[model samples]
Target: MRTVDFSPLFRSAIGFDRIFDLAEAAQRVGEESYPPYNIERLDENRFQISVALAGFRPDEVDLTVEQNVLTLEGRKGDKEGRTFLHHGISTRSFKRQFTLADHVEVRGARSEDGLLVIDLQREIPEAKKPRRITIGGSSQGNLTQIESEAA
Candidate 1:
């Protein structure tokens, strides 16, 4: 595993500490492909995340969003009495974290056919949306035109 030095990035960038941290964390979380998931862009401002959660019920899974972070957790009950000759499906506990961009919010979540789907949308506030600034004519303050010559 290679370690990346981000000291230079830290020194030059402002308000991008979270992005750098997320990059570092991604490197550390290499090859963690459990409970496979897919991220699909539904539209320009909408997205969907579908995670395969076989043998896990909707009640056993938890989803939360906080501070621009979306977290999904699944906890399954232990099979104490049941014995399987060949177990194919895995019901292991898992947690997944996704970093959301600013103004992005989770719309809803649902489980169907062993797939957990989460919907998200980016909703920019009216105040934040870009507006055409009409550069009107100069102010009407010079109406008198400085009557110094008339004196």
Candidate 2:
């Protein structure tokens, strides 16, 4: 396995720790392929994630988000007394995690037809949005200057 050293980049970057953590997470989570899922871009700021969970009920699955990470978990009952001729469909437990970008929020989630769909939207706050600043504004005199006391 190959690993990258991001120590040098840490000195010059600010507020980019999440990106490095995400990259490290992606590298570490490249092996598992159980319980396949899909991600879709609905629009400019809208997105969706569809996870295939056949033979699993709504109560058996769980979804949660914390610290910009979305987690999906599925728990299935044990097949102790049941006998199957051919076990094709997977009814096993699974766990999936997704990293969310800044300002992105989960709108809702629904389970329908054996698929769990999660809707997301990136809604930037009004104060964070970009605004055109006039080069020479007429409110220059409105600025307050700091007073320094001599020692």
> What's the TM-score of every candidate structure?
0.81, 0.79
lDDT string for model 2 (38-145, tens) is 999987889999999999989999999999889999999888999999999998888888989878999999988889999999987755665444445565633332
Highest TM-score among the candidates is held by which one? 1
Q: Which ten residues in a row have the lowest lDDT in candidate 1?
A: 142-151
Candidate 1: how many backbone clashes?
0
Q: How displaced is residue 19 in candidate 2, in Å?
A: 4.7
Per-residue lDDT of model 1, residues 1-151, tens digit only: 4889787999878988878897888787765678899999987889999999999988899999999999999999889999899998988899888989889999999888989999998887765664444444875432223322211
* Residue 91 lDDT (model 2): 88
Output the worst ten-in-a-row residue range by lDDT, candidate 2. 142-151
- lDDT of candidates 1 onward, in order: 0.84, 0.84
Superposed Cα RMSD, model 1: 10.5
